[model samples]
Target: MLGSVTTVEGIHYKTKEPVTIHIEHGRIKDIQPIAPDKNNDSLPWIAPGLVDLQINGYYGSDFNTIPIAKGSVENTTRGLWKEGVTSYYPTVITNGDEEIEQALQSIAAACDGDPVSQAGVKGIHLEGPFISPEDGPRGAHDKSYAKAPSWPLFQKWQEAARGRIKIITLSPEWPGTIDFVERCVDQGVTVSIGHTSASAEQIDEAVKAGARMSTHLGNGAHLMLPRHPNYIWEQLSQDGLSACIIADGFHLPESVLKVILRTKGEKTLLVSDAVYLSGMAPGTYDNHIGGRVVLTPEGRLHLAENPGLLAGSAQLLPWGISHLVKNGLAALEEAWDMASVRPSAFMNLPSQNGLTIGAPADLVLFELIEQRMTIVQTYKQGNRVFDLTTSTKE
Candidate 1:
């Protein structure tokens, strides 16, 4: 058995005291608080590795556009590991039936019977084909194929996935959507709302039908709306609903992000709606969504013709955690929770607590030098997957 011991005293689960974590064979063996050690004083904060429930692609791979092969999925999974993402749901949005089936088949093949594959890829998040038809609300999704939820269609997709699809996102206002959400819930699949123009009443009905999450809550809608009585307010006030926000600093302004962190602490999860252009050098690129988008100097994706409209985000989970910390929106611990514990719970994953003995040995170590968080190491099942000190090698 291989093992390593790490003592982190400065920030443990958002606390000030130092905590020592023991790992053996990719499982957390022990966790305890201890007095600071002079030798370990330089070590920075340690926390559970991040989990993102909605990631389209990273490091130049677009889940929707890339041919689903083990090599493609493996490359994408490895790319995410470098960002400290221990686990994520590969989001497949708005695509044709054949394309969706091919993508799902690829993911299942890549994940089957592989340990590292299991570590990062939980399952698929199907995000479209049942969204609103409005141009603005559809938010870059292909409108030609957009349609109302159909039970037969869902059954076909689920069959094509061979039970690998875990979550589905749709607009509740669509005909038969409520029944579809209920059916999906009954079948043990999560249903989330997105690309929607649902009213408060429609949202409530969907919630009652078992839609518990909102997909990228603030990004896929009209820019201006009645301040107090908007979809944002409705989602915020719903106690049972959990939402994900793209904290890449572009999807939502700092002030709005602060408000969300404050009001939805522990209730809100963060996602990188990162596209194919993520992690690539800044330049103009073609979005498979049939439009030209530019990778901004600040690492955000914007529509080439209309800079006001964001194409997607290049930020990963670590950057999101730092955004929360830098803006004072959440305490370091709280930000970590958004990235780790809360998201796991949202997805009903087995390991929801951070660094607890007997939990999966997925962890991230970072130094907060001068208030900037930098990932120093990443561990998956007690084995080092990413070490910034050395180049990434399989």
Candidate 2:
């Protein structure tokens, strides 16, 4: 039982004020304002532990590469908890049907009898197999394995996922994709547009068909494009689309990042898009997508062939928040929302109980040391899942 839990509640979604959050048995019991205590050493700026809707892999473990073993999923969940992510969707990229099926099965089995596994692994994000086949737009995906959206094929994958597939990202302009988007929407699955070369009209149609998000908005496309007309601009201008951006500083330039933050504001969700190389020692490694990637000196993962092209990201949610705050792209509260509440809302989860009564006891404790957000602890369902000080000692 927490004696007196406190959080700094955001006022008007941009400013924070001290508020107490009481928890009992993994759920929020009460929330109330508290006077500042001079004797208390704990900082009051607590927030909900982040929820990542798109995570590929971390700590040298790729869900796509990891064999479907009993402990692999559990180990991955533990790794994610250390990064302050209390919940996330394990993203699976374009791959063979058999491989994808096996991954889903493993994830489902891992969720059994494990709270972190069950809570951390909300669902699966299928990122491809139905996407643009063009070179630049396809990014690191294998061209041979890419295919147009086929309901029959999707049905097979969905069955293998055992109804745990929550989101599917595909190109809206692909043949039969509009129908596919409709079908997914009808089944309560989110359809995101990505790896595309779609026209404005096609994008609009996809939105009408319930396509709601753009995956890694600016990372998968060609570097140069015709002025005043581009798919990036089209997607940016669409009011119905929420964009996920990799804020690892390499996927997009500072200018473009500022433009996106200013334009999208609360509509933008921060995604790591991290690969297996994340949290690993710096060196060259072969991405499963058959390209050579180098973990850079500055700690970013970049495509070895084209320095401009990003292989993936190494940043986590807390790091992204700190970067955004340091760069003046957004206020600390807004950045926190992007990492925590916005993504949850986008995934259709409740944004309430963020230090409020009757909410889940999913919380993060951090301090701003010289304006840097440093995570000190992470709590899931009222259990202390991660503590940086404790982990460091071990």
Candidate 3:
């Protein structure tokens, strides 16, 4: 339907129809259904490239490792292209004040110096130092630095990030949570509740004060809590809060995931929450959060000494999406949207338009063989960036 444009053809990820997408000037120009060809069976599925809201690092690049090596962020950006991530938030977890400021500065510097870093690093996700210091609810974050929120301290880090800190995850159990959440909202920063042991009333107050989301809702919490009115239940009850779940299979079971999907509906979004060891082979490694963690052959990352305790998520969004589909927790289309347009819409990003006449041409082509998703090609702004058939691919 569009004139003289470079077109990409594949089966639509949602409709399952063979179509040709016309691209021009870095956006979608038109999309038209095409008759199935003899080789249609070999064509990959096409959909919007993934948008990850929480990711620490990838491959050997660790964002939490302060004074991050030069080119690390840039390398990670290109590395994720093979996995179909077009936009992502580089997460900075709980740490000493000076260390956290330095980490933000390094990331901001990377974005300022490199075009690739600027393109991929949508914003910074400040995940704590303001979270709960309680044992189980603290998850793997270091407790020594956990403290109450301070607007002045946060302003210092924001200055280091050059105003790129878009999301802050904190616990409402702290005394000044309402005021902090309000200030963050006023600055156009999204406040997400996480790592908490907050009571029902505290959660309600935070939601009323402008906390709009939950960071990996089910993971950062007390392992044991009363069944009646827990923080998890409270977050689930808040229709105003969007739920971000780690569907990596090791985090939440099918039933809970189903409940979240049903409760949140269009508000459900997926986050990788992946630590630095995500793409590494199964092995033991020194982690910043947990003293020593082991990445199992099954891809689960757990504390080495206590095999039963999870250290952090080692799988990314593609694997999480695959797990949901493999377990019948969500349809392929819905699972894909949870990692794509749904998250984009929650963040109010331009990619939320998704597969329409004028959406950004951030697209991916992939296969779903045996319920496992594999990226065949990825395009950002209508330009092919990764292809499976090439040696340059990851």
Candidate 4:
């Protein structure tokens, strides 16, 4: 029940038809549509594995914490497969120069040492020493370490990461941001705007300089803004930029998510932006970054002092996908794509082909019962990784 197989049978995620997907040599070899049997209604839905662009860490592993533990990256990678995530970027946030370098080196070393990490960690997301230092925009990042983007400094981190840093999130508020964005894009790193108070004109300039994404577009900004000239408006207007959002229900309201989805269309992507507390039990937990945080039974992670404030995203892609479907912001197929296929396409990964022959055979089997998505199994590179039928893990 938990071993690798040549083929997987499930209901097609898109067409809702019974299908037999054949896998070989870690790639999809064939996809056969089959006539529905009486038991077809009980089959799980088959979909492409999720690709998360900005996950910080999982369970007890933290990328932001200085001196990442020896096997943390490997542990995080294996933990994610259970959540149906086959590819992901491990996000390292603002910190002291040496701390960031050390963090990168540890992750790079883990990837080099562990086959699972090497395969699952698509890249590292360097989320800042280059973001806005303003109170509201800075979020939980250390303001003392915030500074202008520097290509040479990034190169040092990239070297430490073994050139695994693929996405860099920075604010375009600094004077030379356009040049920095250009440089990052030149090195094949995705330049994303985030944690900013930049003007619309500045955002336009960054986009022109090849900034192609917005990290959690509507968050990490001043709570109040000018009606039409704000950074959010500017990002939404830039057709060249794909917007990643945190759809944990608490991070954004339905109206805003709906608007962004309609505006960006296929450009809309979902990111958990999850913290180490994710996948933990429902209880109050001490967080070094935010003092005290609470993870609710319903999966909402918020500040313990004030329930109104969000601590961080404590859920995975399935929660976000289910939230979208439940809220009527999108149907199940489109919502699933936002968390899986869409991110892969944005990053130009092979999984973008999604349930088609010739793509990487990273796949998931799940069932949606009244908007709760239960991952039944997950396969990475055509090999079964997680099977709920035999797992006793949380």
Candidate 5:
């Protein structure tokens, strides 16, 4: 149980043993197993704070909204903390030049102003404007603003964002993209292939140019395609490219999720790809991008006018991890690694901070009951950022 001190006792994520973690100066001081405390009602499992590489928004706050609402970014970070996410990328999708500029500037200002934003919002994810204009590959992004890749434009956005844009997702089919990828990699920014209709040869060229990841691998493509030589299979076959899957059960079928998990193995990661309506009530709602969309009782978010195509997801990373575990797609430890260890490792960030000494004290205390996960508490840098008892939590 959490007390008035920085030392916390729970089951270690790796060893599955009861242990006590001592924290000092916002870093883990030591981890030692202690005798079982019979008084504890729930044997909460302690794991590294979950990291989400792509999140558009949560609750009623949309990260892409121009002239960002007051406290919107802060509110999103706080809401994610309750869901066990301590680090994430505030994803901005396809939009007009002015809207993208303002959104990135607002994010940079928010991070500069608040400690919570600085701790949780690791960087910005630009997911569009350089993607395919086709219906299936474009997904829900506004095609009017979509265009060929431009290095100068990205530099301007990076300037406005104060160098916080770390990941840029684009289609490799566009001309000059290979050169753009090379430039971005030179600057330490991760380039991911997404929203594309690129052929296998083009995919290989992207990898050669330093594209390190595939953004939401299975979702941003035509529903119907040739079984062979598809982008999904091509990405799956590439050993150098890490793939991020939604895994919320709504984005990809169970069988497909299993194949991607098995194929990618340790290189696989989980991304929410959650839109503005993620935590909102299930009903027909007018969205800025997907127009009229319906959030179902079972948490499926799809276009109301056309139910065939999904608008986005309505779940978070923790929920996705639970779904993977309960469906037998992965063991509990492997599923958790997809959300924490794998993503952090791919991002070049330290992994397993919860169990490592001298690492940041960011962690989540949760329990699995009847295959459902419950987040009991969350600590970021030795501070109690979220607790189950707080009513204003989400």
Candidate 6:
């Protein structure tokens, strides 16, 4: 019955009111403000589930690798639930043409085989094969596969992915970048500038050609640059482009994070950009991107061979949010918005604000205890996908 409901009482994120959210048939039916129920004091704050735009992999599963192990994607989806993420994009980076096609097909197959995986996966983020091939700007992506942007190549990828590729990051300095960006825009795909040494004019032209965002704005670049006229400053000053930051505290310093947050304000998005070792224990491990990466106890992942450069992030989105709050880079609410609201809104997704009637009941219940944010429960479309209390009992 429409009237039959499961009432979820908590402090609402937007109104900051104590309300009982009624759920029926995987949607929020109603939200009625209620007096504080002292008997249910253990309830946590309710907010929109987190959305990550770029997650390469987690727990030893790299999305760019073809022939993924059995249940790898499903396991990764469940791992994300532990941190209150309801929706995310599996990022596919630079690889051989055959490997890239196989990876996309594997992701599509996982979505087809599992309802939960399909629900959590928003789409795919293609992060490479069209970026700068220079050593520093190329970062960890294989140089062999890096090349100029091509429309036909993207069309083939789209066909293999079953049209699930929603975002692509590329360098605007390439020869055919403008035409490719325009075509992607026409097809309702998001274009982000990254891993490039594009001049200010190139950046402006890319924006004019329909680039809407900067992928992990402060990363995938040379270690040093001129104080002015650099790609970073150009993207920051561009009013037409939004920026995504990796707030994991390793990719960017706190001072840089604060500056970007201030400059971009509402346009800033927080992404995990996590790799295969994200959820693994701290240790040295061999990886496909780099020869060897060491996960330090301080939660930093560095190339064991070089030791000067980072491999990728070892933390998820929640840790980034918590790090921002703890380091005073941003307030709790502001950081949460970057992870949950801003990314979805930038992607033109529905229900950017949480707990509205008739919207899917995708919600997260969390609390800040002793300055550490903890996930109490996570729900997707009104189904209890994760519960810390229940999991411990089992």
Candidate 4: where is the Cα deviation over 4 Å? 1-3
- Predicted candidate 6 versus true structure: per-residue lDDT over 1-394, tens digit per residue: 0123377777776666778889999889898888666755666888888999999998888796667677778888988888889999999999988888888888988998999899889899999989999988898888999999888888999999999999999999899789899999999999999999998999999999999999998899998999898999999999899999998888999899989989998999999999989878999998877788899998899999887789888888889989998998888778888998788888877648566898778888888876688888888888878888887897
Error of 1 at 54 (Å): 0.6
Which lDDT value does model 4 have at 289? 92
> Which ten contiguous residues of candidate 5 have the minimum total lDDT?
1-10
Ranking, TM-score, top scorer first:
4, 3, 5, 6, 1, 2
lDDT by residue (1-394, candidate 5, tens digit) is 1333579878887788888899998788898887767744456999888999999999988998787887888999988888889899999999998899999999999999998898888889999899999989998888898889999999999999999999999999999999999999999999999999999999999999999999999888897989898987898999999999998888888999999988988989999988878878889999887689999998899898899878889899888998999999998888888998788877877545446898888888998988799898888878877889774554
Q: Model 4, 94: alpha-carbon shift in Å?
A: 0.5
- Candidate 2 residues 1-394, lDDT tens each? 1233333232222335556666776788776655666533455467887988788888777778746545766777888777778888888888888887888777777786676688778789999978888888888887887888988878888887788889998988777888999999998899988988788788889999999999999978875777867889998998888999888777787788898888887899988877767778888988766578888778787778987656778778877888888888888888888888888878877543365577777888777776566667778777777877888898
- Residue-pair clashes, model 1: 3
On lDDT, the stronger of 1 and 6 is 6
Worst 10 residues of 2 by lDDT: 4-13
> lDDT per model, in order?
0.79, 0.79, 0.91, 0.91, 0.88, 0.87
* TM-score against truth, every candidate: 0.93, 0.92, 0.97, 0.98, 0.96, 0.95
Better of 1 and 3 by TM-score: 3
- Record all residue pairs in model 3 with backbone atoms less than 3 Å apart, i.e. clashing: none
TM-score of 1: 0.93
Whole-structure CA lDDT of model 3: 0.91
Order the candidates by lDDT, highest first. 4, 3, 5, 6, 1, 2
lDDT of 3 by residue, 1-394 (tens): 0123379999999999999999999899999998868888888999998999999989888888977877778888888888899999999999999999999999999899987679778899999989999998888788899999999999999999999999999999999989999999999999999999999999999999999999998887777889889999999999999999999888998899999999999899999998888889999999877789999999999999999989888898999999999999889999999999998998899999899999999899999999989898888888888888783542
> Across residues 287-310, which tens digit of lDDT does each residue of candidate 1 receive?
767489988788878889999778
Q: Score candidate 2 by TM-score against the native.
A: 0.92
- Which window of 10 residues has the lowest lDDT sum in candidate 1? 1-10
Judged by TM-score, which candidate is best?
4
